[model samples]
Target: MTNNDIFKKLRVALKLRDDDIVKILSLVDFRISKSELGAFFRKEDHPKYMECGDQILRNFLNGLVIHLRGPRPEKTNNKPQKKSNN
Candidate 1:
């Protein structure tokens, strides 16, 4: 229903710990502290409960992509060689 809900479910399903999540987020150049991450998992009624934002969710999804599939390879230019008749 909510971003926090979705994030919580995914984290459980993926069996990811706080550190693992931090690493995954880092893969996409998104930085999140462990304490901030913990807030997302807190109960809704809890004082430290923090709603997950679109940017954070989007970055997590992007980072998950890189984490699972590995980073894309860099492209290089290579000119075709001319053939000579023997």
Candidate 2:
């Protein structure tokens, strides 16, 4: 499933309304219009505003994850590090 699909699914699983999502977003100081919010719910692609910045999108995802998955975890880089010893 797409990321947006996962988000929407989480929204339903959490019993959160679109207005609820919009409200939570506003509570975190991210201003988004109801029409734009509606488009996000209906979108088959990532919302443009979300893709525009890491902080905003991260905050949004963090909120949703908190609602569905519970507290946020620290992000980790799983990539293997290159070793250089000369």
Angstrom error of the Cα, residue 4, model 2: value is 1.2
Leading candidate by TM-score: 1
All candidates' lDDT scores? 0.96, 0.64
Q: For candidate 2, lDDT tens digit of each residue in 1-86?
A: 55556656767887887787776776556787776666546644544533224554566776665655665688999999999999
Candidate 2: 10-residue stretch with minimal lDDT:
44-53
lDDT of 1 by residue, 1-86 (tens): 99999999999999999999999999988899999999999999999999999999999999999999999888976888889999
Q: In model 1, which runs have C-alpha deviations exceeding 4 angstroms?
A: 76-86
TM-score of each: 0.85, 0.52
Best model per lDDT: 1
Steric clash pairs (candidate 1): none
